[model samples]
Target: MRILHTADWHIGRRLHGFDLTKEQNHAFEQIEQIALDEHVDGIIMAGDLYDRSMPSEAAVAQLNQMLQQLNLVDKVPLYAISGNHDSAIRLSTGTPWFKSTQFYMYTRLEQAFKPVELPDTQLFLLPYFEPFAAQQYFNDDSLQHLEQAIVPIVAKMKTLFDPNKKHLLVAHFFVAGSATTDSETQLKVGGLAAVPAGLLKDFDYVALGHLHGKNALHAKNARYSGSPLKFSLSETKQEKGVFIVDTEPFKITFKPLTPLKNVQQLTEYFETLEDKDFYKDLQLDNYFGITLKDRKPIPNVMARLREIYPNIIALNRADGYETNVEGSGESGKQIRQKDPIELLSDFYKQVAKDDLSPQQIKWAQEALKIAAKRESK
Candidate 1:
């Protein structure tokens, strides 16, 4: 069977303050086109269908439209699982409806034993789960680590797995030896979260998620279909795409997805940025993280840059400029002058090394308000 492996859709994700709805929709279209062109029998999405537990209406609608095109229109079987970022209970809705169609979605731990049987293959879907949940489900107190927690689940699947046929494991976890980026949240499950690749080496193919790079893990048959779009400035060099695997002959090929806008970095003064001819040849539609070498901020800098490069996502001062802000020198009490929300946001940026998403900021603001009210009382 010819199958396409993809993961980490993060459908509702935003880059800093920039909404990525249009870019996300474009990427979905490309996936649909790939499915149609490849004529794959099935598509396996490892996990993380959405960027957050509670997605916006527009994000939900985008997913609905894409699923309609892939499952109903193209008529390819889709098997997906919920990842760490997903709310398992919420994603479990419409289970009966999904099973009736070519869609198979798994969110709970018990779903691992039952494989999705195909013509000559068996697919085991394992969604993201906490170590405590796994321990309770199995009633095994000895399950102190992630690998130990998964051991019993894999043992159960082994009994049902047909060695005569091709077997694939679609799961979301941090496998040992996988390269990690800042975009990933460290799952502090028992403080031991990495699972050895050797445990999954028996499967014909292992389609994984939770790691953002395609080659995050180095197992023989395991690979990550990295996030379709770049999520962080740290991932600027990643080649985003999906993996195509042929089961019969056991061959795998990677097909890169055309990004809506490439992510690049430019460090120069305002004069260098004004060299329109230089950047025009480099494609203005690409997203950029600009660094200003000038001593002071330029007036209407973003406005002027947008006229040439319309997709700038981030900008900051280069070296030798310290304003006691988040990225500036860390020895000043300038943050005390800001409001509670701003101070909290700056602190978060300092720790996380990335700006908080709009949703996170909103939640932080509400929490700060509650704290302030309590103090007033």
Candidate 2:
């Protein structure tokens, strides 16, 4: 059976507070197009179908629309599991109905492990689970580690799994070989946090998720399809794609997907406002995170950049001597002559939003004063 392996859709996810619904929709369209073009028998989404456990109504609508399009327009079966970001119950709401449509979703560990038999292969779906959840599923208090908890589950699954047939396993977990970035949230860590790759050796091919970077993990028969979009500036250089797995002979190929908006980080040193062309050189069509090195504070720098690059997401000024102070042997330290509390109040006034509550402002002021005193010592 030919299958497309993709994961970490993160539908309804926002980047730098900017909504990514449009980008997500565009991506799903590409996925459907790929399915049609490839004539794949099935599409397997490893996990993280939504950005949050309690997804927004708009998120739900978008996901439903995409699922319907994939099923109705493409006429392909989609097997999916809930990741750490999803609420198991929410994703599994229409399990019975979805199964009829050949769009299977597994949310709970108890509901997982059972092989969903297709015409060409038997797929073992393992949804995202915490240690506590695994413990509850097995009804065993002795299950202390995630590896240990999964051992019994896999052992039980192996009995049901027909070794004679082509078997595929879908899972969402943090394996050792995968890479992680600041943008991706880490799973809960405890004694029951990890499940080793060795446990899945019985399966023909294992499609994994949880890490965002493509080619982050290495296994002879296992791989991560990676996220469809770049989630962070650190991932700007990554080639985002999905994996195409052929189960009959057991071969895997990567199919690249286009990203709606590229993310780029730029650093520049500025001595005067005339360095405007430096900002213009960057691709404004993509989101830009910029760091400016200036000897002194430039008035309305962000406003000026906004004129050329409207999609600038973040800005930081390097505080080194060259940027903040020119030709000064001693580090320029502006002495605060005002009362500590008043100085803190002014600092809060500069950074706090207009909608900040009075209590919040008061607390911030006090916290800043305490912090400053600690630093002085």
Most accurate candidate by TM-score:
2
Off by over 4 Å in 1: 185-192, 294-300, 322-377
Candidate 1: worst-modelled 10 consecutive residues by lDDT: 183-192
Candidate 2 lDDT by residue in tens digits, 1-377: 99999999999888888888888887888888888888998899999999889999999999998888887666789899998888988998878888877888998887776789876678889998877777887788888767777788888888887766788889988775455566443442412255687788887899987778776777888888989998777777788988888987778888888877778877776443235565456556678787777646454678877776677778887664343222333332452455655545544444442355678768878888888899999
Local distance difference test values of all predictions, in order: 0.84, 0.78
| Predictions: Cα RMSD each | 9.5, 6.5
Clashing pairs in 2: 145-192, 146-192, 294-323, 295-323
Model 2 misplaced stretches (Cα beyond 4 Å): 184-192, 271-282, 318-377
Instruction: Give one digit per residue, the lDDT tens place, for model 1 in 1-377.
Output: 99999999988998877888988888888887888899899899899998889988898898888877888888889999999888898888787698777799999988887899987999999999888888888898888878889888888888898877899999998888887766554432424488888888779999998787797776779998888998888788899889899988999999889888877888888788888766767877788988889765355678887887787888788776546553355555655666777777676666666788999989988888898899999
Give the TM-scores of the predictions, in the order they appear. Answer: 0.81, 0.82
